[model samples]
Target: MMEREARRTPPELQELTEQLSLRWFGRPFIHEAVYNPRLRTTGGRYMLRDHSIQVNPAVEMMYGEEELIGVLKHELCHYHLHLEGRGYKHGDSDFRELLRKTGSPRFCKPLQAEQQRTVRHYRCADCGRQYERRRRVDTSRYRCGKCRGKLQEVQ
Candidate 1:
């Protein structure tokens, strides 16, 4: 099945961010909104120094508008609070309150493009020792450390 593309242009994203800010937070988002290709698992991030919001391109491309909006809101919570000299950190009360008020998710979903872990299970043929590895082990060359037994693939 094909995934829907929800990627927005930079200008469109900026407009959306501004609209959301005015609609929910009752403040204008003055800083720029830009897509960041380098952002992997993170949906969005608000730069403390530049006051700019960087959004992961994968948010909309893989997730959808709702997820993208949620990421935007999450970053906005950090943006507004930090600019006002209030508690903007995840641990702070103000940040938590804003998140609650805005209904923004505390964390973004993991990227769909992220590689899934490959776990290889192995057992010693002689000693019955078990081992889990990310990569395949050469059973012919590698021996069990415990009993120096030959290892066999479990699955």
Candidate 2:
């Protein structure tokens, strides 16, 4: 059996989140804020049950402090609005208005590493058509769409 190591939440992260809460939303953050290393795609997420905020540590490491702050602000918007019985979801009008009022970003910038992912290339044996995919495809199971030719991986 393998045990996963626990990652400690930095004290400064809590302090920064609290400060941003008061500075931007003019309200105190009474909940916890921690860095979650398991977050792969999203910059941050606000938990409705615990009212806590989980920030992806990679956002700061990959994009820097400015991007991190933007993520925090965006999450903070959801925090304040939800607590006040207002719209907190991205599709809600109140959420959009608050985002505009707070000057928080609507979307976080894509991580640099995510943009540099290697793409797999494939070609059809008969049609000579090419395709690019992020994940590998089974040549035996899949075939060309146009010419119904067998697909061969390229490099």
Candidate 3:
């Protein structure tokens, strides 16, 4: 995977976060920015507990620096706003204004890992109801929601 090929050192991410914070927000980033491989969809996350940021390594490896920077900016918005005791979440007016002012993305682009998912189809034996799911469903342990009928996989 690209995530394995182009892994960034923690210091590099931290430095970038600090630089962007200072340049744009006019404040120092006192917390850490570490790569977390377990992040599946979102590019980065700001921890409320320690005021730290966790970035997905796959973002830099798969997309590049521009995408990484956008993620950083988004997370930094959360960090700085939270520190200032302002609205920091996506739905907040302060967060929205900050994103627009900084030209930061409101949301991260969907990850490639999520695009190639295969949908599994199933049908209820008695009701003829159909269902689609991202994962395989065990018929023995599950039933159709509508009519409480046995579900059978449909090819």
Candidate 4:
């Protein structure tokens, strides 16, 4: 039973989204909500063509139910505004106003995995100058700008 309850089924997620729509937006959600595991950088998104809400399953797994609810609310704001032919884009006044009125987050918190990314630190062999990069820098090809010294990976 633990495995069965490990994740919310698609139907349960759909129901939850619908309920949030009614409670927060004062309107019933007629669209679908599904888990999109491919979402790496975002917590959730509202699809304009299909009017569906795609949630990153990792949001709930890493941040808990409250955070998941916040993501849902953010997506719902976009959904309702777009359907009503109002300004739904992030930069629009209508979108910002609705977000403020509903207390929905303008942006979701960064995922733990994203926050904990390994940054490669490099040091100049001669000058001892330091550099940090998200991707590995080839020590053989790259040299330090300060003293034109050989770059070496640190730690």
Candidate 3 residues lying further than 4 Å off, grouped into runs, are 1-4
Better of 3 and 4 by lDDT: 3
lDDT against the true structure, each candidate: 0.91, 0.89, 0.91, 0.90
Task: Provide the global lDDT of candidate 1 against the true structure.
Answer: 0.91
Model 4: residues >4 Å from true position, as ranges? 1-7, 145-149
lDDT of 2: 0.89
lDDT of 3 by residue, 1-155 (tens): 34435546789888989999999999999989999989998899999999999998888888788889999999999999999999999999999999999999988878888887999999999999999999989899999999999999988
Top of the candidates by TM-score: 3
TM-score ranking, best first? 3, 2, 4, 1
Tell me the lDDT of candidate 4: 0.90
Which regions of candidate 1 deviate over 4 angstroms? Answer: 120-155
Ranking of predictions according to lDDT: 3, 1, 4, 2
**Predictions: Cα RMSD each:** 3.7, 5.5, 1.9, 3.4
Could you give candidate 2's per-residue lDDT for residues 48-112 as a string of tens digits? Answer: 99999999887887667887899999999999999999999999999999999989999897765
Question: How well is each residue in 64-125 modelled by candidate 1, as lDDT tens digits?
Answer: 89989999999999999999999999999999999999999999888775556678999999
